[model samples]
Target: MAEHPAYPVGLRLTGRRVVVLGGGQVAQRRLPALIAAGADIILVSPEVTPSVQAMADAGEITWHQRPYEEGDLADAWYALIATGDTEANTRASAEAERNRVWCVRSDDADEATAWTPATGHSEGVTVAVLTTDARGRDPRHTAAIRDAVVEGLRDGTLVAPHHRTRTPGVALVGGGPGDPDLITVRGRRLLAEADVVIADRLGPRDLLAELPPHVEVIDAAKIPYGRFMAQEAINNALIEHAKQGKSVVRLKGGDPYVFGRGMEELQALAEVGIPCTVVPGISSSISVPSAAGIPVTHRGVAHEFTVVSGHVAPDDERSLVDWPALARLTGTLVILMGVDKIGKIAEALVAHGKPADTPVALVQEGTTAAQRRVDATLATVAETVRTEDVKPPAVIVIGEVVKVGPTATAPRE
Candidate 1:
């Protein structure tokens, strides 16, 4: 009779010994997942990639630092023999077999007793896909299927059995710059559970398209034009929705605390005795410049980086910023909501003692498909802004750190 198929089961590898008999690309790819699983990983190899070596140095894993010995699998519950040397892989596999431990062969999967599946996780659900044909199965095909399942789970096309309860409360979720993929896993999971999403114009809008048809979407920008009224109305909407026993997600771009007025909303909810949760997002102040290939801070270039709101012009009486002190300080200055007042802001900075030739970068719609960069010096940035017609929702970076990193651009004369 034919043998039964390999029964699928989840392994609780927390604190369990997992022996990896290689330190090449295969090991590098597998180590991270194993680390996430809380495995007690012991890597046996003569040399390792820089990243794997860093992991060992950080005490995340143990490095054997030599060829695999026959008895290395003594107490290993699982083993992966992926050494480039055929003889070493053979020895490791044989030792695992002698100890009755499940062995996965990276070099010769056909001879192995176990196979790694294409895996992904969404909303606490782990999906693992394995092909029946061991000899010539396409990994990319399996991976694509895994990705489709994950996307479905994330976008609410597929639902998990243990989905989060649609609690009647507010979640202030930071959408993370502009990239849909940049959002936190918890934020995505909470979004899937949202019955009403009060969204900002700058938040990841692509995700909204994936929401279930039953979900209510409110636009913060459409709530009357005066800034104070608009924010007050948004706060009212959150309380109103949650009071009606509906789950509300206040989806904002970047971080809620980074000039997002998240605390104000929380305080409003608290006044009504409504419990709220805040899931922080990747702030655009740093991510946007990085997307344009600029680091906000660099070693010896700028020790400190300051992010300021340019919504109010420096000369405005309501503005509390010390422009002269800012100009005198020597570090990176990142300005948000400053595109409309770039000319005045630039002039003020230069007048106060900031060098006219300080490099500046204007990253528009950063981390998105339409991301564009305009490079200039502080003296000429105003003109560059006018010439390029740079729009709002852009990040303005000023400092020598702009000259460092991969995407550094030459300043315009």
Candidate 2:
């Protein structure tokens, strides 16, 4: 395949309608980057996987659950044929041409619109190394090695562009609510000096811009509500990035410790040759609530606070958080990802002991300008959420915390 001389052009997938044609782990691996690139993606497959389902549910992607049909390609701007079934992908490719939609054949060697290049970026500068791959080598393996090699070359060419890596202390920086500038001054300073930045997707574009252009940004695999790439992979990525004689910043949104899986990664690093340290952050767990003017800890209405994940599996074989305990527990109860199970959670709390009228507020896309909140009670928060169009990336606050301010002050539940 001849490389388009303009191939390296920075491609912004923003607002384009993209169709992904697979639903398995491979499809999962391909989804986030496209979503991260801001493409409006729709997955077309008979059997959709959980990650894809969640993205669809969160309204991040449009999920077509039925089997692929001929006309599915009609209005797409670009299409990605990722169905493991090569025949389906091939057929989709053909359909793409018929509809005049630009498409990438996930399986074929020479038939498609754009080949996904090995990608890496710093600040707003994006770099992609296109593989001529004429020998028909495995593109995935080749891309991985190419990315690593590029990093080695980048290390030597960089100076002040990467001073962030040479910083003396770890900055437990909050990447910010959304806009990169919302990040604390301390966070920016640390990011500026971070020799090694281990970032999740939560880190914003501007925060990343603080890094040297050559800095190696490891792309970690995200498995929603499920296990992430083994902690070993993340630990090794950070340790290796640092051992290459660079400083490291283990970055997470809100706070590293707040359900951010910071402890697990830190332990892995500590077990290996690397030592561990922490920089505390402004936890969105509470800050997002405050932004909505609904305090998690109020003066008279609320005091104690308990944070729990809506998705985390019980650690003990015999867990103790039955509805009775939850209902009776004092202070505030903050639940993450409890949206799907909001009904069950509320039901349990009420049935066990809590009042059905207990106030509950569900906040999503928290702190960003797009934030939405649904306020209700132990009995109706879920129903309220269903009717209100609340989405994921949300946090839930139950108990008297809902009454922190004048009822009129915060966005209504």
Best by lDDT: 1
How much does each candidate deviate from the true structure in C-alpha RMSD? 4.1, 19.5
Those runs of model 2 whose alpha carbons end farther than 4 Å from true positions after fitting are 1-182, 222-229, 313-323, 406-413
Query: Mind giving the per-residue lDDT tens digits that candidate 2 earns over 1-413?
Result: 54433254555689987888877776787788989989988888888788878878899888888777787887788888878777777888889888888777767747886767767654344556666554554668757866665443433223234434343323334565455555654456556556667676665554675567765555455422235556667666766765666667767777778777788777776676566566556676777677777778777777688877776323333444554666788789988756777777777777778888888887777767678767888777777888887777788888877876554223334
Please give, for residues 148-183, the per-residue lDDT of candidate 1 as tens digits: 998878766676644656558999999999898898
Top model by TM-score, which number? 1
The lDDT for every candidate, in the order shown, is: 0.89, 0.69
Instruction: For candidate 1, give the lDDT of residue 106.
Output: 89
User: TM-scores for all candidates?
Assistant: 0.79, 0.53
User: Least accurate stretch of 10 residues (summed lDDT) in model 1?
Assistant: 1-10
Cα error, residue 276 of model 2, in Å, equals: 3.3
Candidate 1 Cα RMSD after full superposition onto the native fold (Å): 4.1
Tell how far residue 21 is off in model 1, in angstroms.
2.6
Error of 2 at 298 (Å): 2.4
List pairs with backbone clashes in candidate 1.
none
